[model samples]
Target: MNIQITPLTEDTIPGFHHVLEEIVREQKYLPITEAPPLDTLRTQLLEQLRHHLQHFVAMVDGVVVGWIDIKPKLSLPYRHVGTLGMGVLPAWRNQGLGQALVQLALKAAAELGLNRIELQVFEDNAPAIAFYQKLGFEIEGKFRRHARVGEQYRDALGMARLLEIAH
Candidate 1:
């Protein structure tokens, strides 16, 4: 399967909405709500794209199968840091699409002058944690009882990847 990464554009909004909704629906361990209406999602996505973030779509066979977005933290102290988020369709997972999306995000972050990238994953999502770790992310912290999934409280693991570490 040939996978291609392209910059997200207004024309691809519908495809993005479809892929996002499908991914959210198939997520078993993570808490993901149904995506907003298409119009709302389009507006929100355009607004975000206009900001300091970059969004990319992963396409296979002319269909959008995944997406990744990264934005630099705006706080003065965190100006060099970027946060990344990604989602892949259920049928597209385990085919290295997730890793490809993340690598694209990292490249965008580096181009934007970000020295670090961070993300939060639920502790129970072992596969995600392993994926991030395989990409050189290190667990930096944890939030106990951070989110409620159903009746149980779940912990969140904070992970970060430093683009350049001073020796």
Candidate 2:
């Protein structure tokens, strides 16, 4: 399969949402079981674009199959930090897509003057935890029963990676 990693564009928003919904419906990786409304997602994406944030998508033969995004904190004290979110379609997992996407985001964050990147992953997702660890992320804390999807209660591990910013 031919895979290309590129910045998300306005035209690709629908494709990105499709991949996101597919992953969310699986009830495995992300906290939400459903994708947000399309218009809402579009507005959010537009805002990210407006701010020139780090939002990227992996396209296979021109179709979005996975995405990774980092949004900096809005508060003055936390503006130097960014929160990361990523998802790869089940079929696209196990390949190097996730690593590539995240690495690019990390580099961009450092260039954007971010001092740290943070993420929260469900504890049951061992592969994701291991992946983050391999990428130099450390588990800072755990949120007990952080998420409840229906009758299932899941614990979340807060992980972060520090970036070195050049003067």
TM-scores for candidates 1 onward, in order: 0.90, 0.96
Error of 2 at 51 (Å): 2.9
Question: Each prediction's Cα lDDT score?
Answer: 0.85, 0.92
lDDT of 1 by residue, 104-145 (tens): 788888888888999889898999999999999999999999
Model 2: residues with Cα > 4 Å off, grouped in runs: none
Candidate closest to the true structure, highest lDDT: 2
RMSD, one per candidate, in order = 2.2, 1.0
- Evaluated against the true structure, the overall lDDT of model 1 is 0.85
Mind sharing the TM-score for model 2?
A: 0.96
